[model samples]
Target chain A: MIALRIGLAALFLMIAVTVQTSVLTNVAVAGVTCDLTLIVVIALALSRGPEWGAIAGFMGGLLLDVVPPADHTAGRWALSLAIAGYIAGLIRRETSGSPVGPLGVALTVVLGTAVSFFIYSATGSLLHDPSVDWGEFGVRLGIAAGYDVVGAIVVIPLVMWIMGRVQPARERRRVAP
Target chain B: MLKDLGSPSRSTSSRSTAPRSAFRSAGEAPLRSAGTSRDVRRRRTVLLLVVLACFTLIVLDARRSAGSPVEPLREAAAGVFGPLESTATSARQPVDNLRDRFAEMDRLKAENEKLKKDNEDLTRELTTSDYARNRAQELDKLLKVAPAYTMTPARVIGIGSAQTFSHTVTIDAGTADGVHTDMTVLNGTGLVGRVVRTTQGTATVLLIGDRNSTVGGRLNASMALGFVSGRGEVGGTLDYKLIDPKARPKVGDRIVTWGSSGNAPYVPGVPIGVVTSVTANEGSLGSTATVKPYVDPTRIDTVGVVTGPPARAPRPQLTGKGN
Candidate 1:
């Protein structure tokens, strides 16, 4: 069952990466595209707990870093997403087992995306990448977080539903609430 | 062992002391599976190790070059994911066509207006002088020189920016199709970019609109040499820095590639853009101007890679003004 869950998460992440690169790239609003992979990482982290979240986040981030047309450093996304997943998992622990409202979910996704983009840019500047211009960071961060919030509304529930389906019946009951 | 037991008990007590009575009052839902203290410790350790590994990889890949160790890993990933991207792109073609059709009318209207204006200007120049006719023919021949080069056409299969923060596209031609790093890629309109990385079946093209990209440019009117750098936005203006401090560049001047050492990255005489604006301050290092590129980097669907330059160079033509 654990293996099945891992497999499910990996499959979902790969699809998210492909779709994000090919499809979502054309659906830009304000020149910023939504990040489906990041949302998927957060969803898995919230469902499975911190350790699982970090591992899944690392894998997803690594894929983003190495995927075709990705010319950035190899581990920048991995570092950012892993940290994002860990924090999101901590949020899950803090609000353990309690049903969160739509507002709570939106807030979490926004904060998570904002923090992740921040870390990515911060590390980029530290690494001396000329692309990380701080002058545009604030506006880009706002647009990226806003776009991701819209994606999370549709993606988070779908991921949770799939996660519940792959679990045993007894575990499903625990996950359904 | 005793100390470990004490710490776990203390941590568990601290965990239970949180204000959870309100949540528990509603109903008991096993949202979280209970884990032993060892599990918590192990999870934290795992998180630490993963983060450390990422840091190490980042530092190692910070200065990527032609022969970096990360190149193999990047190529391997491209080989694995290239097929998936191509499939997804092909499957989405119908939807893409619908979107394109909606914008087609406006684009065609704009193109018609521009062509009509050009026709009027050419007719007037033709009647004015034989020199104008010769210059026009020279411009035509320069453009015709493109077919002389060996070219490979490819379709764009993916658009990506989430990871790199730069504008880039994945094309469905790679080493298998004679596409390689530093090859010049262009569309029907004008310059697109150069290939940066390639797998067996796919290649990554770094668009000229990326902030990190810099291309040598020559002013069409004044023949002044300069460097053009992207402003980091698709369809945004490019920054051109003149090489000669004494050379004065004006707005409305055209630009083209100055040609690289072997023309591997950029071939000579490829049109880049027209100057849109110029800065007032003329520093010791020459003036700067903004250029509006001929090709809209965002809207390109297909591009051709120049595998080889023309066998012989075209004779340099003179403008009506003496060189």
Candidate 2:
């Protein structure tokens, strides 16, 4: 079950990150690319709770950080995404049956995006980069958050279905009753 | 149906890891979230390790002097992603061209660069033409100035730039053309070196830019005497130690050869070069300046050799051009 889940997560991460870095770079809206990797991480987090979610987020974020055309400090994204993913898991743990409404997915996406951007900008400022153009940065973040929210509705359910298909027999038996 | 749709989002259909005993305790909550303290501790440790690993990577990248260890990873990613990006762009080109006149900005940028390069080439051509026209007038003036000494025009077959160490050239005019060793050489503007060696058909003329060569020189404005010698590179220098301490030669001063005895090696009143930089002498009690030569040794193509004695046939009266 663990192997199957990990394999599926790895595949999804590769597709999401590759598309986010390569394809989405050109198709920009208001100078912001849709962070599909962030959406995938959110979906994985919602599907799996804190521990696995944090693991998935760390690995996914690390890939994003190391890939080519990466301009910022390495590990900045890793830290932000890991925390965001963990928070997402914690949200699932706090809520019963983890609900399916678009409202919930949208909130998680916005909140996750906000957390990631906040950490990224804060880390940049701390590292002596004077990222003082709040107006432009804020607009991009806002657009990205909105973009992620829209992606969440489709992503969350899709990821859940895939997870169900790949569920281990032992776990499936345990949950069947 | 809505219940199934809503509950399935939690991925409850996936096999649960929790025991049935814990399942009743947790009711509908996911099993991983309701873990023992051991699970909590393990999760904390993994999270901490991930953060620590990330922090280490950040520090490693920041301290990267030339290239980071992860550079290969980035290269591999680029190798993978670059072609993918290219493929996507190519695929989109047709659809893109159909809408909004695709790649307008790209075409404009290319056109801008081409226009900029064209403008630069045109400007360079105009400058070259202006230089050629002015050089023609200077050569014409030379004929009127020194009419007594017969001038043998020889094409500069080889330039000093072809040689690594010495500023010397082989001219087409040599012994066959009445050229010999020690004949004074000049071009449209000023002093080229005298003939150093001559073969059956070609001669090598030493230029003032040669370190072994020096010319007895006089400043045009102050009549101050100094020796101009080559640095064996491009320009020569005017020795200031010989000049009187009271006299100061300013920048842009003209230097002309103060003719050798009987005008054997170099003729008199021939312009050598112009002063470009003046600096206080480090060890001596005077100022020294660099002179950019009138004839660029590397660019010489056509030259004249004085085959005989100084122009004693009634010196041409000094005119609008300098003596």
Candidate 3:
């Protein structure tokens, strides 16, 4: 059962990463791409809790790091994504009722993306990457956070619904459902 | 695999040994809290180890270069994901086409109006300037003497990838297609960028509108030499220092690449942009202005990479008699 969930998470993450690198890139708003992979990691964390979230974030981040046309250090994304997962997982199963879970998911999405970009940029500067555009970085950060928040609305419930199907029936009864 | 590492069935057990409220309020507190002390310890331990592993891997990979042992894994993954990405992008092409059609028509109309005005200006100038005609005639011969380049066209696959924090476009060409770093990339209208990084099947082109980009430029009207660099905006900004700081560049002045060392990163005389505004600044350089680039860097489809020395770019219409 665990393997099945992990497999599902990995497959969805794969699709998310591919779309992120190819499709979302061209559909940028204010020069910011929708981080589909980040949203996936957040959704997965909310369903599976902190530990799994970290592991999933690691794999997703590693894939992003190795993907073609990436300009930064390989581990840069790995570290950021891992952190995002951990942060998001902090709220895993913590909220109850209708609005709370969704609010938690929304918060996770916004905070996760913002932290990931902050880490990426801060690390790049620390590494002396001159190509870092400090001027537009602030605006890009805002757009990235806001973009993920919008995507989380649909993605979070979908992931939770899928995870609900896979979990043991007694485990499902513990939550609001 | 991971769930089995911890006792999953007992955590969800309806056994009398567990408290109901622990699961009721928190949704699964017993998964962490109801378990034995060692179980909680182990769960936290696993979390720490996973995060630590990522951090350690990050440290190691950041130190490694493109030829790291993990390079093959990345390549293999790309081999799979690249095709999926291509298919998805193509499927969405028609939707993008429909959405952009009206906007594109408006742009084309504006461009047509500009071209008509330019054509009239050129005809009037050609009739009046004999010296300009002779100079152009001589320059055309000089262009003939320059090296002829072979161009391999490629389609741009992605623009402004979120994973990549740079002003670059990923093209469908790479080393396999003879594209290399520093090769000039251009579209039909004008300069786009130069190839920065290439893998087996794709290359990243760094656009001239990036803040990091620096191109030497010459004005067609005033003949003033300057450097143009990206302003981190929709267009680029031009800077002319040292030479003719006193002469203020006017609006609508055409600018072209003044050439680069051996014409590797940038070739000579490629159209960069037209001056849009010149603002006075209290400094030795005196003034600066915005430039409307010839190519729309945001929406490019087909592009060419100059694998060899490109042919000389023709001069624009000569300015009025001066200096």
- Candidates 2 and 3, the one with greater DockQ: 3
Please provide, for model 2 over B1-323, each residue's C-alpha lDDT reduced to its tens digit, 9 standing for 90 to 100.
22332243344313333443354665554454556344555656666777787778777776556666666655465455444443444444576455453475565445545533443453234223423254445435544554355567765543322112245655666677798878889876678888876654556687877666788877766668888877655433334323576577778777777677666687766678788877787777877768888776645655778787635522233334545
What docking grade does candidate 2 earn?
incorrect
Per-residue lDDT of B52-126 in model 1, one digit per residue for the tens?
Answer: 888888978886655567778888878878898877876776754565654755654555455434433532443
State which candidate has the highest lDDT.
1
Error of model 3, residue B167, in angstroms: 1.0
What tens-digit string does per-residue lDDT give for candidate 2 at A1-177?
Answer: 678889999888877776665456445464366767778888887767677677888888887765533534577778778878876765664453434356777888888888877776676666654322344467667788877777777777898779867777775564344
> DockQ of candidates 1 onward, in order?
0.57, 0.12, 0.44
Instruction: State which candidate has the highest TM-score.
Output: 1
Error (Å) of candidate 3 at residue B243 is: 6.5
Q: Which clashing pairs does model 2 show? A: A171-B15, A171-B16, A172-B15
Model 3 has a DockQ score of 0.44
**Candidate 2: DockQ?**
0.12
Model 2 deviation from native, Cα RMSD in Å: 22.3
C-alpha positional error of residue B244 in candidate 1 after TM-score superposition, expressed in Å: 1.6
Where is model 1 more than 4 Å wrong at Cα?
Answer: A169-177, B1-13, B16-36, B95-147, B282-285, B313-323
Ranking by lDDT: 1, 3, 2
Please give, for residues A119-160, the per-residue lDDT of candidate 1 as tens digits: 788888888888776777777778888899899999999997
Candidate 3 per-residue C-alpha lDDT over A1-177 given as tens digits, one digit per residue, 9 for 90 to 100: 878888899898998887887787777785678888888988887776666777888888888876655655666777678778866765553342222456667778888988778877777777776667677677777888888888778777887788768987666665545
- Each model's lDDT comes to 0.75, 0.63, 0.67
